[model samples]
Target: MYAGNSFEDEIAGLEEEGLRRKLAALPGAGGKLTIDGSEVLNFSSNDYLNLANDPRLKDSAKAAVERYGCGATASRLMAGDLILHEELDMRLAGLVHQQAALVFPSGFQANLGAITTLAAKDGIIFSDELNHASIVDGCRLARAQVHIFRHCDLDHLEGLLQTHQRGGRKIIVSDGVFSMDGDLAPVSALRQLADRHGAYLLIDEAHALGVFGRGAGLCAELGVKPDVVVANMTKALGSGGGFVAGSRDFIDLLINKARSFIFSTGLAPACLGSALKAVEIVEAEPELGAELLRRAKFLRGLLNEKGFDIPDEASQIVPMVIGSNEAAVEMSGALLERGVLITAVRPPSVPDGTARLRLSITLAHDEGDLHRATEVMAAIALEAGVL
Candidate 1:
């Protein structure tokens, strides 16, 4: 029996650096959560539309279970692809205004497949500096040369494209909405740049789907069609899976060449059913996203009024930088003790010296909830000498 003493040292090192992570066994989802039997205002969740616990989504999941049973049983190519999977594929394509879509087990896998398949060995990938970890990993997995441009800096990206100009494939990838900063990408400008450089544009709408473009995503909202759109069902859609939408030919290429999708099991039927229903609801009530943004603005205003340095981004995610790892952890714990759940985000989730409280505004949080949480946060900051 080998006791890994090296792992023990690594664990101790994490704790000393205030980077150790532990799981909290919360009973359910949504804006209000019970942490150890005490109800708290949950601002740490990513369910921006509050659909995770919605009755309609639950019923859809139940129906899917009764119809298709539990697991996928095998890889999609090995007979696990069901009718529900096909329906979800079409639904997601329509939702993002693409010619086709291919579903994956998760958003991470979707990115791993899309980027690797699109950028060949001779190609180059110019990605945003602050893109999601999944995209970063995808770029690494691909054999293509990857050059990272400054975040949302079009001039830097154009310079990279020009410097690395080649006849082989060129792909520019970015997040429609940065998860940590909660800022939108310049989608329209990126589209123009891709056209000018004869490159393919890929935008991950993981944070913007079901909350932007009347649920069609940020690209659709801006009428800027990228060569490929990568997104997830877990966030605002209130389900579990991922999908990549693009032209029919591009999807076919992914089907043939993407190792992640080729080797992985098909998305589960329950997730497919629930995600389909979530898309339907979003289509029927486009205002749901608008109203959620409105609430976010109201809450941001409240936090700003309390003297917290909240950015003026329109996305539901609002971050409050607390500087040091220990102080951020202390602030999060203080908020939790005061019945507000805002988990602290530290490196490498964020950069060093930028530890923050990542507040995700969901539809479940009302005006009263926002007011009370900010009041509590401001008081805690003052006590900690942060205000």
Candidate 2:
């Protein structure tokens, strides 16, 4: 409870190691943003469909506020469960082709709730090594026997499952699209393993919702239904909340047992309303998802032609794997100076010596924007010997 400059010293150490973080004042929206008082072409956002400032969503939010006021004054279990919340839950379940769904205040809380509730003590949770921090923490909170398989290594996962088959309530968890590496998990293969090993599978589709599978997600795109699916409305839906979808019984269990859900206040009306409209838009306009994938492929091709270390993928997320923390920070600063807003992802967000720039593409980015961004990034990468 008592410390003398220890917190300051730790922060200074983080600064020295290029691990310190600071918030930038970003005032505007979409691909072009007003960051630090300058108009920059932003590639750092997770708004895959560029719907954050969508007029339709704004109108829906406005209507919701007029009807339901601002905040959810109590928890969902108490007095905060509005009719809109029930409608949203039903619509979300329909979106994922699940029997039921439950909403949380944020994606992190959703993961924490789902994982901790499903895989409790006396369970074995097989997690991907590069799963999101929320999933990592969820596994820890579950207090289960956790086994981490190599990222996307189906054979390794199978081996671990085979060895741990005779266990109590086995669970396999992975990200539909890894946040940092910008690579997709092998959902089909994982599903097969789960089926064979009598284990339940959970896929966190935080980064894959609006940009994949006709706006359903990676699991839907691949025709592999997981036992549990968690997603964030903030990223693809351009709203603020998270959801868990699965069988009716599973969702009911979570509603009863998940402390994060039962204890926290319900999602605000504005977010629920905006997200409802966003889901409708995503489902009604399938072309938006296709266009997002096309842009991602185009960007990957452009960066690859320039000899940057980007993976060949069709998802809207692209990673430029820069090896050093200092180099990543320097490159991020240089890009900002050049009127581009790409973030430098360093250690803890990524593994050691695998720092990167997590470039994200959205429906708002056009051919010209992609060309200009790639040119600037290629030049900087070449100068820094990162290409």
Give the winner by TM-score: 1
Runs in model 1 with CA error above 4 Å? 1-5
lDDT of 2 at 384: 87
Please write out the lDDT profile of model 2 over residues 1-387, one tens digit for every residue: 347568888899999888888887767766778666766888998888989999999999999999999998899999999889999999999988899999999999999999998986678999999999999999999988999999999999999998886657999999999999888999998999999889999999999898788888989999999999999899989999999999999999999999999999999999999999999999999678889888889989888888776778757888888888989989999998988899899889899999888988887789998999999998898888877
Off by over 4 Å in 2: 1-5, 35-38
Q: Alpha carbon lDDT of residue 4, candidate 1?
A: 62
lDDT of 2: 0.90
RMSD of 1: 1.4
What TM-score, to 2 decimals, does candidate 1 have? 0.98
Worst 10 residues of 2 by lDDT: 29-38
Return the top candidate by lDDT: 1
| Candidate 2, residue 171: how far the Cα is off, in Å | 0.5
